[model samples]
Target: MKITGYRCLTTQHDWGRPVGDVNGHVDSGITEVPILVLETDAGIEGVATGSTHDVDRLFPAIEGEDPRAVASLYDRMIARVFKSGHAGATFGGIGTIDAALWDIKAKLAGEPLWRLLGARDRYVDGYASGLDIALDDERLAALYGSMAERGYTSGKLKGGRDVADDVRRLRIVEEALHRNAEHPGLMLDANESWHRKQAVRHVSAIERELDLVWIEEPLRRWDAAGHAALSRAVRASVATGENLTGLEQYRPLMDAGAVDVVQIGAVWGVTHFLRVAVAAHARDLPVSLVGHTADAAVVHAAAAVPNTMPTEVQDLGSPIGVTIDQAFQDGGIVLGDEPGAGIRIDESEIAARMAGDGWRSAAGPHVRSHRTGLRLATERTA
Candidate 1:
């Protein structure tokens, strides 16, 4: 079936508690989920529930083409924006379209995406990540305790600003996950809020009290040398790459032995994950899937990849009008036999709740504080 056109809409994922990291938090615990629907001439439509910006510029690349040619169309989308570069929103648009195309392809084959992607098993292991910097102690414990009850044996906490506070919070998560596993996996995300030296010191201090599995985004996304140095200095594995948009951005870090766990964001689409997972596998590095709300599509890709670590579990539920044919059980995501990614969007329900993101707070975590990186200098002088 040939691609005809696309439609876009916005929905919301309510975390039920404030979610944020070192940078900012959404006090209302709600964030907007962008939905993309690719219409086909033969009455088959593909859906993607993530960022779908810049479609006006990128759609022409795949227009009138067979959706089954997902990879070629993906490359075409990238090449379409060659001069402008595919990073931020442009890459997001490509990722969403690519995911929809893959969805259509799998639907056409009359198989679930994991099966079509050659995965023998439909289960994708996951770790609970609360993005809980904004949550209070009681709320944090409640959030993770619930995940533990769901059989998650690992959890990642967002922290890096205050070492003492981070240590305390990590202990809370450890205690929560301990209900499922004796030695539950623990991780900390600095969210690119710390400098290289600051990362070393902060993580080193936390290591004194906890055995962390990894520390994510300790430095900026492109700091290959700094990440390598930080990795060498700390015992916990350094994980980055969530903010990176393409394969070329990962090469420098891979060559430098910078990242121990290579992370591929779910928002970047299925093709991107497949390519990155293969590349990371060649280097013998473990790949992890960064979670997004309604991330089932990429989880299918994660299941087919041999090098995947536990994917992140950000939200336990779907947006208001979206339903996913997957179960969060056995400490992971189990896919249904439904064709494609198994995400069904109810346009009427979405229209009824047509609320734009109301979680807007000027001082929230979404806004990076002015003193974010500069504090490293202040700490050194003091």
Candidate 2:
């Protein structure tokens, strides 16, 4: 079916609560952006992109293209903007449009996007990603101690500041899990806050304290050579690429032998993720899907790839996967047999939240953190 129209819906929601780590106090907050929806002639509409900027500019690029030509359309968009940088807000815009096109195509074909992507299996495994980065020692241990009871055998912790303090935090988490015989696998994310030397020093200490499965983006997103050197120096497997856009950006990391695990976001759309997956598979690298708080779309994409290791289940503010209509069993997430992405947005709830004055009232003062240089500013409600 042909494309009919596209619309942008901007709304706000509390993303997550704060958790403590070794570095200091850390919390999660909400930022507002437009979610793109694509409508087709066959009376099928799909949620294309979630929380993206520049919806106005992306509308004209794929307005009349066939929904099934998602890959070709993605190529066209990339070629049209090839001269532009592949990271940051511009690539994020193109990613939104590409995702919408896939949603429309899968809905039209009357099959789940995973089936369309040639997935041999229907379900994939997942890991529990906690949000207790701000808790003290006692509270942090209790938080992870409870997570083991809930059947999460793998977990990720946040780090970026003091090396010794971070090691203490990890020691507590490991001891709590070890007491129960759960022996949960652990991963760490630096969020691109450290330099090469600092990452090496801190991650080496972490490896000694905890049996880390992987260390994610300890340096910067663009540090291919440094990642390679660090991978050689540390025992923890190097994992990165969550902030990356396309296959071209991914190639250098692979060629450099930098990353041991590749993390991809489905919000970039099915076609682009699949392209990256195929390349990663060629190099025998394992893949982990990154969550943008909401990740049902990526759940299906991750299951289809044979080399996919585990999907990251973030314990953030609101439970998007649990609240939505899709089926989540055990620690793994499963998509419905419905066509397209197999999920629907609750438009009434979205509208009500948008119309209310809650978000405007919740907008707090902006505070910048010294460690990550991230400004935790309250976004204006529109």
Cα lDDT of model 2 by residue, 1-382, tens digit: 6777877766554544443333333344343435677787877786754545655555566677677887777777666665754456666667777776766777777788777767777776777666555566776777667655655567787765665666777777676666445676788877776778777877887777777888987877788999999999999899999878778889999999999999887556666677788899999998888763454565677878778888777653332212332544455565567776665565566666653332222322122235442323211211
TM-score of 2: 0.84
lDDT tens digits by residue: candidate 1, 41-148: 999999998787899899999999999999999999999999988898789889998999888989999999999999999998999999888788898899999999
lDDT of each: 0.89, 0.67
Q: Per-prediction TM-score, please?
A: 0.97, 0.84
Candidate number of the best lDDT: 1
* Cα distance off (Å), candidate 2, residue 76: 2.0
Error of 2 at 217 (Å): 0.6
- Give the per-residue Cα lDDT of candidate 1 at 270: 94
Model 1 lDDT at residue 48: 92
Worst 10 residues of 2 by lDDT: 373-382
